[model samples]
Target: MKSDMTKGNIAPILIKFMIPLFIGNLFQQFYNMVDTLIVSRFVGADAMAAVGATGTIMFLILGFANGLATGFTVLTSQSYGARDENRLRHSVANAIILAVIVTVITTFISVVSMKGILRIMNTPDNIFDYSYAYIITIAYGICASVFYNLGASILRAIGNSKVPLYFLMLSAGLNIVLDLVCIVGLDLKTFGAALATVVSQGISAILCFVYIYKKQHSIWPEKRDWHLEARDTSHQLRVGIPMALQFAITASGTMIMQAAINLYGSVAVASFSAASKLQSLITQGMPSIGQTMAAYAGQNFGAGKYDRLKGGVKNALIIMTVYSVVAAILSTSLLEPAMYLFFGSAENVAIQLPWAIPYIRFCAICYIPLSAIFIFRNMMQGCGFGFLPMMGGVVELVSRAIMAALSMKFMIYELASACDPAAWLTTGIFTFVAWLYVAPKIERMFSGRQKVID
Candidate 1:
């Protein structure tokens, strides 16, 4: 476990580690995809659309929680790499503690804000109750989501990637079964979808925490460590806040796009939402690499293995580029079936197909650049280039604003119909805007890194 950070063939090592991470991520996301599948197949299109309707808002709230856990993962990876057992335990303990805090706050806000947030997304009046009920149910389990994330991250840091993956597979399987029973067999509808999601997540989280408590030597804490040290809390907050807010900013921006899509009605909403669920599978690809990079970079950086960090990034870029191209080819070929899978067989895939296809195809192209942004940022954060990562986060937040301000009017003038040209615009041009914003900042950081070495 310890050797993964500093030794072994870097490329194969990363790929081997990330395969499970990717599979786990796929399964993790598969939990919801299964629901979308079952819902589209049996519960009817409007119900499926109702569930999809809340995705952006979910990202807004869930993304913030994820960003904070990301910070904790960085700290843990670094501590583990340094082989500083004391620091490792401290970070792990605090990560769990921090997860509890963020979870409670987010769950509260999500529940309270569910209806307004849905309304602001301009969800049609008919879908409003379903969105509210689904979101609130999903929010009830935010703590579980964080529990799984934080614990799984710790496992990854210490090179136990497979355990988390196993847990995710088990829980996701449970989710599929429950989803089938709720939405397919019993006819529970949107609220059933939400229940399935939360229960699945809760199962995974509880088992992971219990196993860590009982088994993992890496996470054991002394009584004194229970209360977080001042420096630890301060650093976690400093780093976590920007990371969390980056997601918040991006998620909030997405919420705006969701509002616009809603104005087009349930079909447009269904198309966008269905494509999004399908697209989630693709985005998880390189991000699996980015995550592995996070642990690899952080652990190496903390141990001062600077050369390994350099090698890891080079390998990451090569792999991500190849993947982007391959995914583009596959998505282009599978476009019809993929959309058909989410929208169901009976429905005319044509209605949603064109909409899902272009947006996903655009993603396949932008994915590399987006991944380039992630690799550098994850490395920078892992290395505790604290303020620089935050600066990059600022770039992402600002670019979304820039993209929206400039693009909406043009989109209104252009496609301007139920066809959803905005999907391409939202995920594509907006992403390019962010890439432009981040590129120069990342270049400056590396330039400074070179200076420090010289």
Candidate 2:
């Protein structure tokens, strides 16, 4: 299961690695999508809106956890590529230590701040309690999310994407079953949905840990691996904190946009929420490819295959560009129908569709820039240039803040809809430029080292 990305034809290997990652990503998204669908259908539209309202905040906290876990794995991947088994084991062990600390911090902050965040977003009085219950429950489950991401990330770091995908698939199915049992059978509503997600992810995390312990001997930590060195911790934090902050910053922008949307009341919030879910589903492939590039670039960079890394980036761009076009067509064509999946009542669908459709279409049309953001930014992260990507996230936060402010000032719902595409455009351009500047320096540095060796 441990494959080497540094030695294959660029496009085929990338695609092969990418397909499982894309599918796994889809299944991961399904956890939330299913929660929304079950909550909307059984508990009512208000309940669905409550769950939806929590989306950005969930992204803020949980995204930081996942991003940190991923950043930890970059070192693992590099160690794998360089054939440093000792370093890989140490990286994995240190990552676990950091993840535990992060889990405790993230869970406490998110749970304690949950209600205040909702108030800041101006959540409607109608759904305030439902939103609070749902998100706070999710906040309590941060450990599950963090460890699952950490485990899956380690598997992917060594070119073993399939095991994580298999476990994710199993957990996703369990999530649906548990959603129904709790939401419908037990009548738990939004709280139940959050609980189901947490439990399912916890199971996945446990399974991944078991697999690594039993099967992945190459990089598995021995007794000595547990002796954490300051250097190893520093290395993980150097990449992890910037990566985590990048996600947190982007989510902060989303929180800003959500606050502006909240000004329009629950109807707009519900519409945007439903549309956003559909868009995430449709464009899952972009991020999947981005993740693929991370591993691909990380491995090659570690192996000193700078030319191959460049080739992989080029191939990844081509793949993402083509996928973006298809995703656009799918979003515009399928979005209206997809709304029904969340809202069973025709009246509710009618109320939300008019507001939701344009937003989905606008984002769909601008998928290229969004796609570019994922590809280039992740490639940079994989290559150990984490700071610029974090700066790109800052650019995104500023763009969304500006748009959200404008939307609120003028009461134009349309401007709020434009926030995402605007952020994507600005962030995408910034990251691409950063890549251009960084890629040359990397190549030149490695080339000179090779010359010195010669």
Q: For residues 1-454, write the lDDT of model 1, one tens digit per residue.
A: 3335678789998888889989998987777887877877887777778888888777877789978987876777777776788877888788778888888888888888777777666789877877777788888878777777877888888777788889999998999899888877888887788888888888888887787778876566777677777878887777778778767766775666566566667877787677677667766876788678777877776666656766887898898889878776776676677776775554668777655655565456566666676676667666655455555545554544454444455654113222222333333344334434544564566567768989
Best candidate, lDDT: 2
Clashes of each: 0, 0
* Residue pairs that clash (backbone atoms under 3 angstroms), model 1: none
User: lDDT per residue, candidate 2, 1-454, as tens digits?
Assistant: 7879999699999999989999998998877788888888898888888888889999999999989999988999999998998899999999998898899989988888888999999899999999998999989999998999899899988998899999999999999999999999999988999999999999999999999999997678888888667988887888899999999999999999999988888888888998998889889998888888889888988899998978987888899899999999988888878888877668878988988976887688789999899988888898888899999999999999999999999999988998999999898899889999999988997898899989
Output the number of the TM-score-best candidate.
Answer: 2
Q: Give per-residue lDDT, candidate 2, residue 96.
A: 93
Q: lDDT for every model?
A: 0.72, 0.90
Supply candidate 2's per-residue lDDT for 426. 90
TM-score on alpha carbons, each prediction:
0.88, 0.98
Evaluate model 1: give its TM-score.
0.88
